[model samples]
Target: MRLSQSLIPTLKETPAEAQIASHRLMLRAGLVRQMASGIYAWLPAGLRVLNKISAIVREEQAAAGAQELLMPTIQSADLWRESGRYEAYGKEMLRITDRHERDLLYGPTNEEMITSIMRESVKSYRELPQNLYHIQWKFRDEVRPRFGVLRGREFLMKDGYGFDLDYAGALLTYKKMMLAYMRTFQRIGITAIPMRADTGQIGGDLSHEFHILAPTGESGVFYDATFEAGDPAAAADVETFYEQMTTIYAATDEKHDLAAWEKIPDERRREGRGIEVGQIFYFGKKYSESMNFTVTGHDGTKIFPEMGSYGIGVSRLAGAIIEARHDEAGIIWPDAIAPFRAAILNLRQGDAATDKICNELHEKLGADCLYDDREERAGAKFAEADLMGHPWQIIAGPRGAANGQVELKRRATGERLELSVADALAKVMS
Candidate 1:
């Protein structure tokens, strides 16, 4: 993509309304714009990052045996009524009334809707273990939405539902999801620790929240240092992963166990603030029983299948990642989810030699490169490239271009190297 042809409306001054690093940087970088209170319109660059995150989530969900199916943003009020939560859900739900006098709502979550689907379709134990997921928009009407997408009212989410024949089966699926979540976070280039959490309105005895450590996070957290020592996704099996994760002694301030904290050595103790990115709940029979979802048992008795819900804040992750990864300059995007792998900054935009080298590099890199072909000063180009946070910056100044060399700069480390055009391309591609 050429900068001159793009719609990135980057700002030199931060918006007054943005209180957090993610919010401030997102607006200044032109990733999104506030459409209304608690609502935003994602720009092209932001959408690209969101799509990349969603794709990784879909891949990991499929690998964990969940089938994909999109659910609607609006749902009939009857579904929530069936699960006895229509009134209990509170004002966060955007209840609506159609011209026909029927009640509807922009779904805050899909537990009730998914439960009704299973009640209608699955009638036998043979089809016991089923997991379905979707990536879709959700609305909650937050009363005081702030912090950009982190606390937005309308957002994208990846919510999945799992059904099983019995408690044992439900536990197994929960473990599998834990493993999947670990792998997903790892691939996205973040370390998320799973800590025991209260089920809250979801109503489950077993629940875990995956949190990324950041100083600006909402929740104060205590965790063991082992989480940072090795990759949780490298465990031999789901059970092994689950065991290690659960036994690691991690918790938010509300659930912190002081006795447990003292057992670990001083060097093994770790505490920080945490931003919640995802959560998994093994709420056996909570939705199924309440909604009267039943399946035929082997001996012909009606049975309520155990169920669980897994959720990842798809849109909030974009902000949370920035909160955890950014530096003084701007966002330091993870290579796996960056909008562009590398940016080609034509230091001398109109110089024939520099233009030729940059254009060649852009063509060779194809759509993965963002070429700065704007009529801007070299310093401005450098600043914008850093602000946008491409993993690499290919600098083609007239002097370097004339010498058949370009400078490759790593955005995270500020390390630059002068190399032949061919070598630079190879390194960027690698």
Candidate 2:
């Protein structure tokens, strides 16, 4: 994509309302724009990042045996009422009255809706263990929504629910999701510690929140260093990996136990502030029983299925990643989730030789490269490229272009190499 043809409205200064690093950088980089107090319009660059995060979440969910499905943003009030949360959910539920005076809601979660679907469709123990997920926009009317996408009124999320006929089945599904979340965070180039957390309004006996460490985070987390020593991809058994992680004495401040934390050797203890990116819940029959969702048991008796819900804040992840990865210059995007893998910066835009070389590189890289073809000063181009945070920047100037050489910069490391155009392309492709 050429900068001249793109809609990235990079800002010169931060918005006064922006309170955190991610929020401020997101505005300055032209990734998003505020439309209301807590709502935002995701511009092209922001959408691309959001999509990348969603894709990773989707892949991990699939690997964990969850099937994808789309559910509506608006849900009937009757569904919530059946689950006995309609009134308990409070104003954050965003209750609405249709033109016909029918009560509805912009769904904050899909527990009730999913329970109803399974109640009507899945009828027997044979099809017992099922995990369904969807990546969709959700709304929870926050009274004081701030911090950009991190605590927005409306944001994208990947929410999955598991239905099982028995507690054993549900436990297995929960472990599978825990492993998936760990692998997902690793692939996105972040260290997210799974800490025992209160279920809060979600209502569950077992829950774990995946929190990524960042200085600007809202939650104080204490974890054992052993949790960070294992590789998710290398674990041969999901159950073993899950047990290893959960038993590592990790907890957010709300669940922290000083005695347990102090018992660990001083060298084994670790603590930091963290921003939550995902969570898994084993709620058993919380929704199924309340909604009267049941399957026929082997003995021909009606029984509520064991249930769980897993969630990843797809849009909020963009902010969390930035909070975890950015430096003073701008965002230092991990290669796995960067909007563009490489950028072709035509430093001398109008020069025929430089333009030719850049165009060639852009064409070769195709959608993988963002070509800075605009008539902007070199300083502006360089600054924007850094602020936008592409993994690689291929610098094309008249002198270098004439000599059939270009400079390649690795954004994360700030490593620059002056090599032939072919060599630069080869390195980026590799």
Candidate 3:
């Protein structure tokens, strides 16, 4: 894509109202626009990033044996009433009515709906274990929605629900999701610690929250220092990984232990603020009992299946990644989820040789190279490239073009490599 053709409205200064690093950086880089309070419109660049994140979330979920499906943003109120959460959900649930006087709502979560679907279709113990998930926009009427997309009223959530026959079966499902979350965060270039958490609204006996440590976070968290990365190369056994992670001493504010914190050596103890991104809960029969989602056992007796729900804040991770990985210049995007793999900057656009070299390189590598053909100053192009945060930047200046050479820069590490056009292309492609 060419810079002149793209809709990236890069700002010269930080928007005055933006307070957090992610919010300010996103605005200054022209990634998103505020459509309304707590609601945002994703500009071209922002949407690209969102799509990249969603793709990764999808891959990890599927790898964990969850099937994907799409549910409507609007749902009937009768389902919630059957689950007895219609009145109990409070204002956070955005209740609405169509012209026909039927109560409908933008879903804050999808427990009741998933349960109903199960009751209607899945009938026996033969399909004892099933995991279904969807990536969709969810609305919650936050009284004081702030922190940019981190706490937005309407945001993208990846919610998955699992059903099984008994307590042991339900635990295996829970374990599977816990490992899935770990692998998902690792792919996004962030380390998330799973801590025992209270299932506040989701209503479950077993719960865990995935929190990424950041200095500019909203809430405090406590975790063990020993965090090993999940081996992507190895076949992940969710049950084994879940048991290993859960046994470690990690907890947020609600589950903190003073004695436990003191027991660890000073070097092994780490405390900091973290932004919560993923949550999992094992709510045995919570929705099934209320909604009467029953499946017949082998003995032909009707029984309520054990259940669990897993959630990841898809939209919020964009803001959180910047919070966790950026520096003073701008966002330091992870290469696995970057909007564009590389940028081609024409230092002297009017120079025929420079333009020719940039165009040829861009043709050779399409979406990987965003040719900055716009007639902007050298400094402006450099700033915009850094602010937009592509993984690699290729420079075609008058001097380099004359010598048939270009400069390649890694944005994450400010390292520049001078090479011929062929070498530069090979380096980036590699």
Candidate 4:
């Protein structure tokens, strides 16, 4: 799209409240605008990246046998009451009441609703081993929310639930999800290590939290070096592979065992701060039993379906990825989710030669090119290009345009190459 037509409100100075690089870069790049203390409106460029991430999640989940559907932002409180968590959930749940004075809430999670659906429709063991998921908005009322979108009050989440007939079956389902999560994160160019985690309010006996190691993270994570080199997704038998992938020592801050830490050799021990991006829990029949979601078992006796829940913080990963990948310059977005694959800088703007080369590149690259047709200074254009974090920067400067040449700068690596306009566009397109 043309730079003049887009809402690219590139800023010169950083916002004072942003202590983190991603937060500051997002604001300076005009990707988002703060609507309130803990809420921000995603601009066009920002939404593109978010949508790309969501699509990857959806594809991976579907490939792993989970059906996708969308859930509403608002839900009835009666479902929560049935699960005995209406009052127990406390202040984190943003409760509401309609004009009829009936209790309502913006759902922080969808456990109760999914349980209700299962109890109503799935009545026998024949329909067991089912998985369903949705990508939707969730609200959690945090008393002090900060870190840009990292700890936002209202955000997007991808939550999936699985149902199985027995404990053994439930574990198999959990293993499928484990592998799926690994594949999903890998596709997004993130290295998320699944570590044993505290279940928190979810009340599950078995839990794993996938964390992306970053210096300024909230959780102190300890793990073995094997996880760093292993491919959890390639397991022939998912359950067995899942067991192997999780066999190595890994734990969160609370569960970190000093004895275990000392047992590992110095060469294998690794400790670092990590951002939690996804979590999986096999809660067995916790919600199902509370909500009375029972069905006829294989032995013809009544039983509760062993259930598991998996979640990825879809919105928070944006900031978390930047936290892990950015440098002093700006955000270095992964190529798969970059808002634009490349930015065409028409240096010496309004000059016929510069315009001709840039326009040609834009036409060949299709709609993904962010052509900087603005009549701005070289410094201004360069800064904006870096701040936005396009994978490649094509400079159609006067000196090069006069020589039938253009400059291509690789943003991730500080490598610049000069080539003919034809060569440059072909290299970028390929």
The Cα local distance difference test for each model comes to: 0.93, 0.91, 0.89, 0.89
**Tens digit of lDDT per residue, candidate 4, span 1-430?**
9887999787889889988877888888888889988898999898988999999999999899999877788889999998888999999899999999999999999999988888999988888888999999899999998889998898889999999988998898898999999988988988999988878878789999999999989999999888878775566878677877777888878789898888888899889999999999999999999998989988899989999999999889988998898777787888888889899998887788888888899999877789998878888888888889888899998899989899999899968999998888888777
Candidate 4, run of 10 with poorest lDDT: 231-240
Best of the candidates, lDDT: 1
lDDT tens digits, residue span 1-430, model 2: 9889999999888789999999999999999999998899999888989888888888988888899999999999999999889999888999899999999999999999999989999999998789999999999999999899999999999999999988999999999999998999899888889999889888989999999999989999998998778799899898788878877899999999999999999999998999999999999999998888888999999989999999999899999999998888799898888888898988886789998899899989998689999888889888999998999999999989899999999999999999998999999999
Best by TM-score: 1
Native-to-model Cα distance after best TM-score fit, residue 139 in candidate 1, in Å: 0.5
Candidate 3 structure quality by residue, lDDT tens digits, 1-430: 9989999888988888788999998888888899998999989888888998899999988888999998899999999999889999999999899999999999999998888888989999998799999999999999998889998999999999999999998999898888878888888888888888889888978898899988988768887787643453353566666666876788887789999888878887788998999999999999999998898899999989999999999989999988987888888889877778899999998898898899989999887567899988999899889988888999999999999999999999999999999999998888
Q: Rank the candidates by TM-score, best first.
A: 1, 2, 3, 4
TM-score of each: 0.99, 0.98, 0.97, 0.96
Tens-digit lDDT track for model 1 on 52-111? 999999999999999999888889999999888999999999999999999999999999
Q: Which portions of model 1 miss their true places by more than 4 Å?
A: none
RMSD of each: 0.8, 1.0, 1.4, 1.5
Question: Which 10 consecutive residues of model 2 have the lowest summed lDDT?
Answer: 238-247
lDDT head-to-head 1 vs 3, winner: 1
Clash pairs for candidate 1: none
* Cα lDDT, model 4, residue 348: 86
